[model samples]
Target: MLRGTAAVSVQRLAPEDLGPAAADCVFEALAARPKPVIGVATGSSPSPLYQALAASPRDFGSATWFALDEYVGLPQGHPESYAEVLRREIIEPLGLDPRTVHLPNPHTGDHQAACARYEQQIAEAGGIDLQILGIGRNGHLAFNEPGGALDSCTRLETLTEDTRSANQRFFDSPEDVPTHCLTQGLGTILAARHLLLIAQGAGKAEALRAALKGPVSRDCPASVLQLHSRVTVLADAEAASLL
Candidate 1:
């Protein structure tokens, strides 16, 4: 467990070792539930876990999935969009039904209404059984950037320079990435029954340390995970070095 915080269990392993660690936890969750309502996060950090789940023998045909966030103002079929990324990496490989997957609607004209609707949908599904998260180098979860309201719900938010730069590789150029996104807020994520926060590599060590040891504050959005009752911090040895 991470020291100096609440009961957040931490698993320190090598970068290559994180995949099986996370996959095993996810498998346990799915086996215990009939139709798991799961929240899935995107980005390179969780790729290994996604691949492991795809190769796992579990049948997720009845599972319902929710994406953490999506870029606003991107084209319908943009490859970098969270929707496409989830399809290529998770949905297709895992054989999950596309209709059962949900994401905050970036294309909706009434962004506020869309967020509310998405929240309602989650509630209707009996809330998320397990939420998978990836902490940013800046300590942001999903696209929940720093200095925002901790209780804020899903809504449009401007992207920080750090987040944009980190995500630019998926786009043609740095400027090509969208400047805004629609993300589930800290409050929304906290509603999950269980949270699996994954961080790997030495580059993420500082952020992991802050999130686990620092005070609960919006400065490091991920620090809010400490407030949750059921959170598992899965990190690589290098990422846990600072702790």
Candidate 2:
């Protein structure tokens, strides 16, 4: 998946190509380290990556995993929830023990406490080795939308109308979409040793271009990746058109 952006190694590939590419990277990372901690994102975009990892021959028995974000008030069993999606697509197929999968609990009455506890859990697991991401149409990463601070940490955030619209597919109706979320902060995400941001389809071309070619700004949260030491961006022709 690595193509044309020089700041970070960019690879352009078709939408379907995401799965095997992710599997290969996960395998390579696992082989290169001991008990690798993998941070996963939830959405339609990363489904292929999870599939590829599941189909791989490598065993993920000892690996630790963390989710990048979760809707603030959604129940764990909600079909539109990221936690449920990750459990079905990534956790189950990869043979990971459910106990090793860490996700921010939105059910807690103290939301800030949940974020702190989740951060601590990751720290105790020795931090994430690799973090997978998907760019929002508005250039957000997780729920770190426009105006997000450069050094923000894990916390609750309000979802923008654009983000809520984009995520409507997960819910029965646009109104069913949660207006807020608990997401890993820009700083928290950047702490990962490596980042793999994947995008595909003509719809993402503009955001991909902005994230790669545009100046860093809170207006485009993903643009902060430019400061990271290691980042791999994968896009399809439509998404790579700007590059």
After superposition, the stretches of candidate 2 with alpha carbons farther than 4 Å from their true spots are: 1-7
Q: What does candidate 2's lDDT look like per residue over 1-243, in tens digits?
A: 544445588888877886788677777778767788999998877888888887777789878899999997777688678777877997778877899888888899898999999899989999999899999999999889989898888999999999999988777888889998889999999999899888877778888888878898988998888888888887777888888
Question: Which residue segments of model 1 deviate by more than 4 Å?
Answer: 1-4
lDDT of 2: 0.85
TM-score of each model, paired residue for residue? 0.96, 0.96
In order, how many clashes per candidate? 0, 5
Model 1 CA lDDT for position 89: 92
- Number of the top candidate by lDDT? 1
